[model samples]
Target: MKVEGVLVLDKPKDLSSTEAVEKIKRLLRVRKAGHGGTLDPFATGVLPICLGRATKIAQFILEGDKVYQGTFELGIITDTYDLTGEVVERRPVPELSAEEIQEVMQGFVGEIEQVPPPYSAAKYRGQPLYRWARKGVKVEKEPKRVEVLEFRVLAVELPRVEFEVYCSKGTYVRSLVHEVGLRLGCGATLVALRRLRKGPFTLEEALTLEEVERLQAEGRLEEKILSVEEALSFIPAITVSREMARRIRQGRPFSVSVLGSLVRLQKVARRPRVPWLRILSEDGDLVAVTYYPERFSGEGWAEMLRVFVS
Candidate 1:
């Protein structure tokens, strides 16, 4: 049987996210697999691996919020915003209280503009900024707006401050830490980092690579796979009639209004702010994913994003 679903891997440190996915693919013997998001080589924790058809929904999973715990070493600055980069500068560590640091963290909560590190995967003119930086070229990326739902200083020990933050997608925690250091006037850089959660998946439920290898050896690797429907549980489900399901699976689009004309939509009390939805067949299989940008056009059709069945 083909392995198809999601695997939450507890990525170990010093391994890039892509490397982790490659390890999983080789271990599971699956041809198609991809990670939902990227984690820096120095960072480790919840890395969602989508296999087979689950890969199609990886983008939606990546769109979900992320939680990270990281440490900042004050009095130091680096080009990469982490310890691995060259120390660009050094400053004297100033006296700072836990309350003072907490106060500073509170200022970052909510939507704010952030500038990604120069030595980062941020794209500039169709190439990663890091590529340009390697050849003695510097590409300045513009500050982007990101939502910071929570930011708290877990601990403050002299020049070392540990923090935890829950932020929206595309919000670079390293940059947030860098900004906090600048605000303290002592300058800082990320010394350590770990991802605690990504969307509906968490570190607690993630299996380490060793455990996964053991499962494979025990012939129970498939047991670890989470079904496509479970991977999309965060998205609101919309059940349609056989006819609508057939249309969706056949690459035809239909809006909630049009679906109502064919057959009543399973009533969902609350509307989802995100336009993406889980399109389920009458028999209850996830047939496709849809985007309801219906409001943008007079036709108002739920654009068929990906069809699970041909």
Candidate 2:
């Protein structure tokens, strides 16, 4: 009864990501568990909880893009950039056309720099900035670069705007909405947010906590778990002989020349920064994850990233 796979949880509001993971672990009686990404306690939806061996791939999943749908209240500013924080200011909402709002959102549809909110988990001087803020200390952090693939305004109702966004990892939706209000001349604060997708996991594939409990009690919890191989299916795989697999599991680096006909050596004009490959055994068991470069020749060696124990 080894539990090793991913469970997509439709996280409920008011529960921290770590709390959600703890709850899943308790319900499933799993010894090893981790989460792919962190969602604010107030935000709900697609939170991937990795069980057993699946925890090894949680970092890769965390790097994937995310999509969120949320609402922002215009003419209201909060210290935390969301409704969870205290109101800092309030102004009259100016009349604006939907087209004008769309134009402003479109301006953020690319790589942009953003400063994280003061009341956030971002650390300053080895302590969370929120801690300093709560002590009446102000901490101004340097801006960070994040990509925003899409920012669409779903609807506009005077002071409230409903929108959806597709963005790179670490792109704060609350900050994005606050910046939009800044550009519009009236401040705004996030009212509500729901994650639609994170990496390959989606809200449609997620289960509620109660459903998880019911399924576990019925011995059907495994039905919802995504296998480790399935979770990393996006990466290219190379099947090797048992000897090669054994060597990989032992963390022995094998030369590219040994792969020979099994690997199609190619040269690329540009190499990916950190391309990954799944090293599988003859029986299709994932033996290891390795750094396989595209520009490698017969002399290049595959760098082992993680060696599977079982």
Candidate 3:
């Protein structure tokens, strides 16, 4: 069957994001499918699977912030920065208060440079770092800046501490936890992690693999898939006339004046460098995703970035 839309999955532990997408594609019987973001096999929770036409917006979804609740064990350092890797070292857990832990986590807030763990999917010389690590050649990637919106310490139980983090896209919670352990004088390893939110998608609306299979069996799986317009509801949109829609599909340029009051640019602060506008048909079907040029005056013309098969 030809299907299109996003399916939020509560990915199970021990399953890679690619494997999850493959399973969903097979279950839904759709030939075109892709995932919005990558989740470590050891981590589980909200994983948005974009099918058919919905795949076009996957990059936008991946650019959104992510929220995760996780636990880390102090006094143990692992090669992967998580419990899934070989134990690198063991240290004594210093007697510390929850307030001290929170202070360290607070330091990580705002923009901070973080180094991806040696055993990670980060590329090195056109090969995954993990692949190099498996060959006994450890490679340390350059530090990258990632925004940590919130890093609240939820609980402290001596060796194990649980926390929740709200971070920008590309933030590595495992690396964050490892750094926290270092500051505490006891290296740590991530033991558990669950992604609570990704972009506009959340775990509350996600279905498990088994749940999806059952829904497919009942022939109601399609009902849960979110349409392209609904999935990109966070982006600004404008409805164009049938003729204008045709022009957009033909990759034609459009005058800003034509949009008039319909030209609803997102607030300046929230808008990305290159703005995206959803073009809709009179019947409300999404017709195209056009690029709204920066400094676009009322007299200029803008081009379409992607035209949908409407």
Candidate 4:
């Protein structure tokens, strides 16, 4: 039996996200499997793995916000910003009041420039930064703009601080920890980290790899799978009639009036913004995904970015 859905794996620490995917592929005996996002081997938590046809929706999950709870050890800095690298620097941490620490953290709550960690997967030229770092080579890296929607220091212990972060895609928690330390006048390094949420999936809903293996042994793996449509719940969905669905399946576009009607109805019904639609057959097989730019002109209409089934 071929399985098509998302698997929210509770990744164990010390296993790269890719390694976890490989285990899932082997367990399920599926030819295709992809993780929504990559997690550092030292970090663990909710890692969504998509299998078979569900891989088509992996991009949607990757584009969503992520939440993490972790601790940063103060007074020491590592080359990788985490426990994986050697301490490159150490500084004396001055006695700071709770209010002062809170004030310093506030500065990181919005848009800011962040430099990728030297021991990271970021590419310079054609080689990964980690490869260069391993060779003791230094390369100039451009800073990237990343938003920190929420950054709160949950607990403060002299040399260790626990915090929760909610941020946009591509925001690196390791880099954030290093920068937060810079703001506090002391160096810092990530000692432990765990992702609590990724888009609509939460740690509460994730399963450990051991549990997945047990289920697979019992021949009940599919029972734990989440449908592709369910995994893409974060995106706006527009349901079409059977005729329109057929046209979409035939590689033809739908009428402009149909899209206008949806927009008008959504406005009157006070529905959440439906900027995009999921074209589905009457029996519920996903055909294509599309967006509207004013009028869904059939001449250059909603092009199918991904066509799942004919």
Overall lDDT per candidate, in order of appearance = 0.84, 0.86, 0.86, 0.82
Model 4 regions more than 4 Å off: 254-258, 266-276, 292-300
Q: Over the stretch 219-293, how does candidate 3's per-residue lDDT look in tens digits? A: 898899998889987766777789878877887777765654456442322254226777788888888776655
Residues 1-310, model 2: lDDT tens digits: 7889999999999999999999999888899999988898999999999999789888778878899999999999999999999998998888988899999999999999988888887899999888999999999899999999999999999899999999988889999999999999999999999999998889999999999999988999898899998888766777888987898788787876654445564221222323677778988888887666654565867777778876
Lowest-lDDT window of 10 residues in candidate 3?
265-274
In angstroms, what RMSD does candidate 2 have relative to the true structure? 2.9
TM-score of each: 0.92, 0.91, 0.91, 0.91
Query: Which ranges in model 1 have alpha carbons more than 4 Å from their true place?
Result: 259-265, 270-274, 292-299
Q: For model 1, how does the per-residue alpha-carbon lDDT over 1-310 read when each residue is reduced to its tens digit?
A: 7999999999999998989999999888899999988899999999999999789888888887899998999999998889999998999997999999899889999999988888788899999888999989977788999999999989989899998999998998888888988898998899998999998899988999999999889989788789888888777666777887887777675765664433334554334435666777768888877664434334566667778874
Best TM-score goes to which candidate? 1
lDDT of 1 at 125: 90
Q: Residues 151-264, candidate 4: write the lDDT tens digits.
A: 888888878888899987788899888888998879889999999998788999899989998988899878889988777665555666778777777777666567657656
Comparing 3 with 4 on lDDT, the higher-scoring candidate is 3
Q: After superposition, how far is residue 154 of candidate 4 from its true place, in Å?
A: 0.7
lDDT of prediction 4: 0.82
**Residue 296 local lDDT, model 3:** 51
Clashes of 2: 0
